[model samples]
Target chain A: MKTPLIDNLQYANFSPAIFEQMRAGGVDAVHVTIAYHETFREMVLNLERWNRWFEDHPDLIFKGTTAADVSLAQKTGRTAIFFGFQNPSPIEDDIGLVEICHQLGIRFMQLTYNNQSLLATGCYEDDDTGLTRMGRAVVTEMNRVGMVIDMSHSGERSTLEAIDHSTRPIAITHANPHWWHVALRNKSDAVLKALSGAGGMLGFSVYPHHLAGGSDCTLDSFCAMIAEAAARYGAEHLGIGTDLCQDQPDSIVEWMRVGRWTKGIDYGEGSASNAGFPPMPSWFNDNRDFGNIRTGLLNAGLEIAQVDGIMGGNWHRFYQQGFGPA
Target chain B: MKTPLIDNLQYANFSPAIFEQMRAGGVDAVHVTIAYHETFREMVLNLERWNRWFEDHPDLIFKGTTAADVSLAQKTGRTAIFFGFQNPSPIEDDIGLVEICHQLGIRFMQLTYNNQSLLATGCYEDDDTGLTRMGRAVVTEMNRVGMVIDMSHSGERSTLEAIDHSTRPIAITHANPHWWHVALRNKSDAVLKALSGAGGMLGFSVYPHHLAGGSDCTLDSFCAMIAEAAARYGAEHLGIGTDLCQDQPDSIVEWMRVGRWTKGIDYGEGSASNAGFPPMPSWFNDNRDFGNIRTGLLNAGLEIAQVDGIMGGNWHRFYQQGFGPA
Candidate 1:
């Protein structure tokens, strides 16, 4: 059997072209962020959009809810689109919605999105309160319902507390290590050590802000960072989560960062001068260019198995262990 | 390998007890009616309930959308609970919601219940107008989206029109032959002939009033009716639907019969004196009694292959053919 290739995080405005590119890239599964800061009903509308895509492109993709779906996608030569939330806004204040969202085929939900949510503190918040009371209950509920507690945009204390409180191994679905790139969204060394030590996963982000050299970051630098992280964290929990905002209008970035939370603009990673998505590194432009990363990882002194795991195999294993009731 | 066992239709107040009985009966899959006269939002609440059941009892049941789920259910020793709608109220007046409902895993949608709808004339209507403009559009849309057009409670002209209008073979998901038992819900010879001739399916209903002798109907008589149906309509198009309203209270029956359409009770299949769910025949008490029908079919001089098909294999083949983009 071919090793599965998965992109564990993306927020692309998906189309048939992207799905075709996924097939060309031999990507078995992709955990697509269906909700960033949308309300419960709004998240359902997003699901409706995806449902239309699934109907329109059955030959290229289908909804993926389990690890076995990766194998199914590989066998069928299609991409399995798994749903995730970049924020816990979809659940609102209801703990019951954790299981409800899981039933809707959502497998991952970030506790915060660069601000204080009902559950936890975001990375951008001044004061880092750990897991709130609701957060602890939601963590337990998420564990019970097989929905992974994602902490990609959450504060360090909150992320650490999530890793501590969750009976199931949580995930930083997309973000880099702070030691590699000092972006607010990136994880610190302590957080990385704690995450991996607790059998949690850290999916490397290719979003420009999370990169050391921003848009000008080379494939070699990216691969070297992967190699370094693998060396430090032991490669088992490493995988790619290319937060690729492909084909989306700059307006979507505003929605992602701002999303009815504020009247005026809050330029998340970008300044007023550059308040939009940045250019991708040329070598890793899109899914079809995943070959470049694999080649780069191999050239960066990583073994074939390590490269394979980083590409998708690790996420596959993580999905197997993580997306089921504890 | 054991032959798959499927019940093509039911509307039980499903619980762990019902799911366990389904396992005890060795049923692989069941097509459950999730909507009777519920509006779109109300139906979502019902889906939430089923989702809870699935989460709570993963060992016993899981949602089934495709035909492959049957084999998967049998292999995993669980029942695949497939979804359907006995009425098109959930879709409201929007043709787009057809595909949306299909995306939400609704496999079957009847054009009407017991009154004239936006789509077609119900069986109890004064005049039988065929497929409406919306009905034809919905039929084509349903075919394209792979949701079955169930004509169980539709008027004769409408049912025939649907059988002809549908690019894909429509289904009388839970109804009996009118020749065997004269009832408003039972289909006529012409309808069944057109259904089978066009590669459609007839899921025999044991819904008390549809049976010749009501609740006291014998196993021999029921299986003999199956034998007669196989003789007339061909065994390939026949399977069990049961219409098993198991564990539902009289109030639920009231809802099924007189949703929000009328202020007064309609008593769909029963009179004012008998306006509640009737007791099931002694031979077919619940899902656990499926074995009795299998034996009854064999005793009624059907070959083992024929028995197997009626039991579930035929419905499995129908499901495979029916549930996909056409």
Candidate 2:
């Protein structure tokens, strides 16, 4: 059996060193986001930089927007980099932009980051209106455009609505089930049911703040949480969206708190930052070098197929459906 | 039979002359949108203008955000102006912005204008993702913030999801059911059912492009269309959202076509424009001056109570549920 190792999601600040770390860790592929609240010019400029980097080191960075692309990259021993969006803000109010972004190779799109937008309500909103009229139209457009709708920061109503309205499977690219932790950021069983019932994927986030024990959460406890979700919503739809903000400065934390960059309500007051974990252990200080998750799963006696799906196969399948022919 | 006459929605580039016309025509109230894609500076400027205008003519302009406010305005014979939004783009990704705008007297909020945004998807998106994660959170926040969720330009997925996700009833502040006219801009019967089932309101738009006969549609035909919707969805949940873009410049049309203030794809080709109807015809052109819809309903022999609901009573109730007090 070809034991595949994939890191479905990570939000490390992009750098040459990070790329080198990913390559060194034998990481097969990762979804990289481009869209946020940045102006179109800024997004385009970032894309240009990414394109240059990929071109400069084809051995390290391979553009992948489909499951087949990831598989191909894995076979070639190159890390696949799937384009994604942390928010749909760049699309503005035009539904036509969905297709435009799809053409530009954005396979995964998180509806909102920390705040409310045109498509649906975000997690930080006091009241979740679910999906709006425009949000419904967006679901159809994403379906038509073959882009995977990721509801990591979405509100409950909007999340369920997307699940019902989507023609294909959706994904919670990074979220913890509320069962594991009762935070506004966590997904409820109803949400999990809706997502899985629609053949969608739920990428469990490894952020300590969202876990029940906060900073006290351990990798074993996190894996147990995943097992609980699997028991409830099936393992096929389970995956990982580590949501690792590695190499980000403390100023970035302040930016997120101010709702400037993250665009959400401040969660610092009551929530744990690093859960209870000590400042990033030496091996995982850089998310790119965090190879212990796979090993952790193996140590837990999970099957290779289950571990493979959790690591990357689920995300790979999701992308294949979103990006059309490999 | 006391047949009430009201304009459900209108976005007049307001002037003293327009206010004079509204008062002269015995118009009871108008839903005035304050939120567009304007920058914070522009929004503040517009608000200032409105504040000064209201202060200067308290007897003519009454601020409102709920059905009770409309009733109060009606009793006082003052034309109530309910603060509303055509798009939530001004709020951007900030969920707190909803409350800020709500405190500023904005009552109605459409998730998207004509395209994809962070909260919900627009009607024109090739694939409607319905509500984004943030969109859901926004809805919840809106509900908590006491702002009505409007789904005029929102896509199908977003609309249905919004209806399902909202703890309170939602509204399509301006729209036509697709069953009456198969335009992509209209809602389907299923969507209408979901919306109404959730105790939401459907404000039938009087735009010629959305009517069965397009530009050829007369006031009688427009009323007939409402009658059809009333027959199907019931008059209680059916109201008017005139969508009267009176006094708006041709440039606004051009902007709407490109999906943003700036240019991109032009989806407005062959689409109807208010140009031909400039000095708008009776009933819809200058909705305030047109008594034809009231006459048409009476001519059709509908009950005065039903007409009242269709005119503005239902919308008033919607606002009451969305925005407390006045």
lDDT of 2 at B213: 72
Q: lDDT by residue for model 1 over A130-179, one digit each (tens)?
A: 99999999999899879998999999999999999998888999999898
The C-alpha local distance difference test score for the whole of candidate 1 amounts to: 0.91
Model 2 lDDT per residue over B66-156, tens place: 6666667767777888777778766766665665566567878889877788888888778898889999998887887688888888888
Winning candidate number (DockQ): 1
Alpha-carbon error at A230 in model 2, in Å?
74
What are the per-residue Cα lDDT tens digits for candidate 2 across A144-224? 768888898888888898888888898888889887788888988999998999899988776666766655677777777
Docking class of predicted structure 1:
incorrect
On lDDT, the leading prediction is 1
Lowest summed lDDT over 10 consecutive residues: which window, candidate 2 chain B?
B269-278
Q: Chain A of candidate 2 scores what in TM-score? A: 0.89
